[model samples]
Target: TVNELRRQRKLMEKLSMEDHLTGLPNRRAFFDCAERQVEFSKRKSEAMALLYLDLNDFKGVNDTLGHDVGDELLKSVGKRLSTVCRKSDLIARMGGDEFVYVLPSTGKKGSREAETRIHQAFEDPFSVKGRSLKLTASVGIAVFPDDGKTIRELLIVADEKMYENKEKLSRESKRVTIT
Candidate 1:
């Protein structure tokens, strides 16, 4: 009985850390891992990058295509992100079409490269339930020691930057429509 209980506990822990739909690490897992990474980076004096990404027009997709299709799209997005990231990188779903990436031992240049790769990955449409859906994400990046000393602080900065990027895109789209 004790062994079975232990096994159940282990399973529960694993499930708690993973996003059920996308199979990516959940927010709690991200924070737990990020805290350790931040400490390691500080000890080694290494640069790290935190990226906050939010899907653009995700709500529209859910409303138009139904939740099942939206869920599939999230899973596809997760897989796409995994393909673009290195073995060392940490990718997590921060719930509801928002994801976070932790790049250890990476600086501004590396972050920019990663961001470019992510954009390129989105160039192809994701197929969900026999439908082709185009998706884009607004990414905000913050480098360690430059942006913040702690993971929470870095996340805050990254989230703010992501919102700014989303606003810029919205404005640019409006301008293009007007012209």
Candidate 2:
């Protein structure tokens, strides 16, 4: 029984980085992997990317539908995002409606491609609570060793970009004119 307990403990530790809800890696685990990538990039003098994303109109979904449906939608989004990302990429939920991704050994081109893929993933409809829901996400990206020398700075820049995207969307939403 003791050996069995030890084995189970090891398995749990291995899976600790994963988010139980969305099955994406959790924030703590993501940071651990990102730190390693940052160190490697520093040595090779290569560029890496950090992408910060937030679901657009997610709060409206919760308000219009319910929290249960909102949770299901998040899980679906995570699954779709995982399919679009490379095996080397790290995707994680930073709590609430926020997510962060790390693309090691990738620069501007890679970041652009990844962002495009993610946006395309959201173009499809998601089934939640037996209903279809359309969703969009705002993405902000920062390149390592160019945008910031530290992870904190990278996250701040990425968050700033995300907020800028949100503001743009809000402005666009108010611009529709009906004849």
Candidate 3:
């Protein structure tokens, strides 16, 4: 009984640190991991990047295909991100079709390259169950020291940049559709 209790506790702890849908790290876990990465980057005098990403037009998927399909798409996105990003990178689900990545020791060039890889990841349509769906995300990158020294500051700046990119994409999409 004691062993069972301990096992259950450990499972609970793991679950607490993970996102239920994507199986990526939850926001709290991300913060913990990123805090350490930030310290490491600072000590080493290495530039790091915080990437904030938001799914484009994700609500449409949920509306047309239902929540189950939407959830599967989210999972697929997480998998694709892992494939493109470095193993050392820290990825987290920031809830509601948003994610964040902490790329330690990556400066502007590396972050840009990672962002391009991220875009390429979505070039192929996702096969979720029976439906084939295309997805894209707006990614914002903020380099450490130049952008922000601390995780909190970096996150805030990245988030703002992501929203701006999202808006720009939305406008471009609208214009194309209109024309």
> Which candidate number maximizes lDDT?
1
TM-score of 1: 0.94
Which model, 1 or 3, shows the larger TM-score?
A: 1
- TM-scores of the models, in the order given: 0.94, 0.92, 0.93
- On residues 1-179, what C-alpha lDDT tens digit does candidate 3 reach at each position? 99999999999999999999999999989999999999999899999999999988888888877899889989999988888777899989989899998888899999999889888987888888688887788999999989998999998999899989999988878210100
**lDDT by residue for model 1 over 58-142, one digit each (tens)?**
8888888789988998999999999989999999999999999999999999999999998898888888888888777899999
**Number of clashes in model 3?**
0
lDDT of model number 2: 0.87
Winner by lDDT between candidate 2 and candidate 1: 1
lDDT measured at residue 151 in model 3 versus the true structure, 0 to 100:
93
lDDT of 1: 0.91
Error of 3 at 18 (Å): 0.6
Which rank order by lDDT, best down to worst?
1, 3, 2
Q: Where is the poorest 10-residue window by lDDT in model 2? A: 170-179
Q: Which residue segments of model 1 deviate by more than 4 Å? A: 174-179
